[model samples]
Target: LGITFDNKLHLSGHINNITYKAFRTLNAIKRKFRHQDNDTFLTLYKAKIRPTLQCASPVWTPHLKNQ
Candidate 1:
């Protein structure tokens, strides 16, 4: 959950957690729409996962190597 440490920015753990959560949400959506086609899942992914992962990007993103 940490984005900065000692003036350094790290994303390994943060991205991992985000991916996990997004996957879980996607799975739930899939279960809810088990009979839906790929298009439906794709749309749901864009609507749900995209926003959750992109939230507060400026705060978590690193602008420089030294961060």
Candidate 2:
């Protein structure tokens, strides 16, 4: 669950399995890393595929704010 920023039209995808196991894992991570920094991800599914489908991000990003 990191950050992402992209704008294009190519292929498409789907999240066919939004199961409780996923939620439990995410919740566990959130709790475990509660005392850490604000912008952190305990586990990322894909290090390269995540950043290809996002728009408004941290809002504090300098370049994104300019747009």
Candidate 3:
């Protein structure tokens, strides 16, 4: 999935309740995306993933203690 606003693009990987690894990867803090890539925002946040007409909700990524 993807979200766009004011010419900004936010990319979301595959989302499935049974398989959260894909989406989880996006939620990872250390998981940096390639803004230069043609994909999307460079979404570095969790909730950024938008729901599709099909069926899929976003989940929060567990954060570590340290920054």
Candidate 4:
């Protein structure tokens, strides 16, 4: 699993890691598909960026309000 934990066993590190990866993928898609139409961009986003953000979600998902 790609999930990570801190000394306190918090999922913050895993969340941050996935967030960074997702944003980076989004930026890349924006740059590479600048001329693409809305439908095409949506497709790309769903196929690429969404997966990065959603991967291992059940394992790292926050249950506490402060998390």
Task: For residues 1-67, write the lDDT of model 2, one tens digit per residue.
Answer: 4332345521111121223335555666667667765445623423222332222224323343323
Could you list the CA RMSD of all candidates, in the order they appear? 4.6, 10.6, 14.5, 1.6
Ranking by TM-score: 4, 1, 2, 3
Candidate 3, lDDT over the whole model: 0.36
Instruction: Give the winner by TM-score.
Output: 4
Estimate the overall C-alpha local distance difference test score of candidate 2: 0.37
What TM-score does structure 3 among the candidates reach?
Answer: 0.21
What does candidate 4's lDDT look like per residue over 1-67, in tens digits? Answer: 8789989999987887888888898899888878999999989989998888888888888787865
**Candidate number that wins on TM-score, 1 or 3:** 1
| Candidate 1 global lDDT | 0.74
TM-score of each: 0.62, 0.31, 0.21, 0.87
> Which residue pairs come into collision in candidate 4?
none
Candidates sorted by lDDT, best first: 4, 1, 2, 3
**Mind giving the per-residue lDDT tens digits that candidate 3 earns over 1-67?**
3322233322222223423643665555345654434334444332343322223333323233421
Q: For each candidate, what is the lDDT?
A: 0.74, 0.37, 0.36, 0.86
Best by lDDT: 4
Between candidates 2 and 3, name the one with more favorable lDDT: 2
lDDT of 1 by residue, 1-67 (tens): 3342333546655656766888899889978998999898789989999987886676666455643
